[model samples]
Target: MKILLVEDEIEMKDSILQYLEMEKYLVEYASDFNLAMQKIHLYEYDCILIDIMIPHGTGLDLIQEIKKIRPKTGIIIISAKNSLDDKIDGLNLGADDYLPKPFYLPELNARIKALMRRNNYEGTSSIVFNEIEIIPEERKVLIHNTLVNLTTKEYDLLEYFLVNKDRVIQKNALVEHLWGDNADQFDNFDFIYNHVKNLRKKLLELQCNDYIKSIYGIGYSFKTIL
Candidate 1:
């Protein structure tokens, strides 16, 4: 899943971003309100983690602004202010959950996972489709109870395809998600083709049906109705 982390604390922001990345989440960080605003306007996030105290504006304002256009956008308010009024205000303003300061990262991660499950996965830890089972927490894929060994990039690409199955995913989005935000430096997408080739081979070797389809001039799709 992709997460937008908005915070001003250097240490906290770095720690959270690194942890999420290690957990195989695509994360974008914004140190101040303006940077945060720019990202909210530019990209879509599965969940947004906002710190109430920021350099230029309170995270409250950000949640309000984002909720206007993105009601389905999952939001969590993290703040040092744990007063009853603050909690009430955040929840009333459409923030999903409020996490007080000095909380553990594991707890925060759990909260995010729960929010994703409620909003997207309908409160499930694993996604099941036909003979394929995806364990998001473990980042593992099981085909009919047998483990399918995949490279890290291959696994992430497969997960991304599974989530957006039957929808066309642009090559640019794949590059951005797999590489860092700046993937334009690449001369071509030969690397992507390599991964796709290898992933297809592994699935075929496991006797799993191939689901990825090319769009000719556009991109690829993980179609189920095929």
Candidate 2:
């Protein structure tokens, strides 16, 4: 999943980035409130981790703004401040969870997973669509009870398609969702075409139905009969 981390401490930011990346999440970070605002406005994220004590603006303000712009996005407050009022204020401002500093990385990871489950997957550990089953935590995809090996990018692409099934997803949206800030480095969406083609080929090889359909001039859709 894609994550946006808004933090100021260099050591803490680096540590969280490294840990989340190791866990196979696409994470982009901002050191202060302004940069965080820019990121939130420009790209979409599955979840956002914000620190209360940020430069120029507070995390509470960020939460309020996020609720206005991206209300469906999952949010968690991570700060050194552990006051009851701080926690209350954050929750009142629509923060879903709070993690006080000096917290364990595993705990943080668990919180993110739980939040994503609640927000996107209806709190389920596995996503099931027809013959395809995906266990997000394990990054495993099974087709008709048979394991389907997929590259990291291929797996990510499949998950994205599943999440937005039955909806037309633009190629630019795919690039932004997968590549984040680095998406600007690509001049065209040929890379997206290549990835989707590979993923489609893999699923077809497993005798799975072709759910992905190209939309001519627009993009593609993961069409489901139901």
What overall lDDT, based on C-alpha atoms, would model 2 receive against the true structure? Answer: 0.93
Pairs that collide in candidate 2 are: none
Provide the lDDT at 200 for model 1. Answer: 86
Give one digit per residue, the lDDT tens place, for model 1 in 141-213: 8988899999888988888788788989878778876765557689877578788889988887888888988
Residue 196, candidate 2: alpha-carbon lDDT: 92
TM-score of 2: 0.98
Clashes per candidate, residues 3 or more apart or on different chains = 1, 0
How much lDDT does each candidate structure score?
0.85, 0.93
Report the C-alpha displacement of residue 125, candidate 2, in angstroms.
Answer: 0.8
lDDT of 2 by residue, 10-100 (tens): 9999999999999999999998989999989888899999999999999999999999999989999999999999999999999999999
For candidate 1, the TM-score is: 0.90
